[model samples]
Target: MNKWRNLAILTAGVTMLAACTNNPYTGESEAGKSGIYGGIGAVTGAVIGAATSSKKDRGKGALIGAAVGGAAGGGYGYYVDKQEAQLRQRLVGTGVQVQRNGDQLTLIMPGNITFATNSSDISSSFYPTLNSLVTVFKEFDKSGINIVGHTDSTGSLALNQNLSNARAQSVASYLSSNGVAGNRISAYGAGPNQPIASNATEQGRAQNRRVEITLQQMQ
Candidate 1:
């Protein structure tokens, strides 16, 4: 009986590993990570269930555990996929670049479109774009919003950091005022430390001086 149990556990481990490797859901992307996690959860749950159940009912317990674990692990990935689709549809031609990395979604608002030169105040013309974002954020309350302010390397480090911080706060405050829960939002300033482009040219500087809002799943 012990030998059979050991064989069953080994079989489950091998099967899950294989499934994860070949699974369409698994990959280096966020969606793929979700699949790998789901596979791992399934394997872990199956092992636990089988070990805890009577010898005669081990298989049934394992199956139930696998089902539950897989569902739990994949739920967030599904949620992110839907949210991404909605954001892409809403942000069309709005000058907000929607980026997906792993399980997070980032909306990159160019400095030119969101604010005036060296100012933290949001431009009046960007209100509608922000309002659209607020709508989706409210609908998907399960995610946390991280507003990060960034700047070019033209300014002194202190000045750049302060400006970035203020800008991040401005955006965070706007989102909060527009009805996104304050508790679900955080603001930070990255200054010129994390530039997406070389700040040697005007165009590169323009890209660097921007605001990024990233959506992350809440536990």
Candidate 2:
């Protein structure tokens, strides 16, 4: 909820290019280049998420926020290439949804896999995706990973907020556990306030309940 407008504006139209290597957070490999959008997005999202989250949740929030921000920034100028196409095929087979806006690569997850109604336990099924992400990160030369958590707008505002935070933390924990470093990853929860679909309907609610993973260059 913090500086979304300003961050989005500053990230618009920015482009970046870099090499891929092992992420400090995950120790897994990554691909794709880094960019201005990714760097700024990471910074803005981390700062804002840290400021708004409870003290207990701030570390996870910063990790997720930075990743998503970096993804958004790197994504703005990304282009699909042979490697990305191959990555897409691999992700699709593993139940990891992939979306592309230009050069940016967005990975979408069903809430069921990333969280359990206010709980932050990472599903076993999610590990393959995480491993794949690490591979992608190592393959590319980017320095950011965007991890964003979302929820359906059904519960009280406070409950949803905590749920979102927990979800983000869960994903961050998984990445860190596997090999990701705290410096390269950022996490955050949008609660129910940043719904991408209508929460009034089950289909829309499902759409709204998700976590987005973006891989791009850091600005």
RMSD of each: 4.2, 17.5
User: For all candidates, what are the clash counts?
Assistant: 2, 44
How well is each residue in 76-123 modelled by candidate 2, as lDDT tens digits?
Answer: 354344446657756766656877654667888888665565577877
lDDT of each: 0.83, 0.68
Candidate 2 lDDT for residue 140: 62
**Highest-TM-score candidate:** 1
Give me the overall lDDT of model 1: 0.83
Task: Predict model 2's lDDT versus the native.
Answer: 0.68
lDDT of 1 by residue, 111-164 (tens): 999989989989999999999999999999999999999999996999999999
Clashes of 2: 44
Model 1: which residue pairs collide? 27-32, 30-102
Q: With candidate 1 superimposed using the best TM-score fit, by how many Å does residue 157's alpha carbon deviate from the native?
A: 3.6
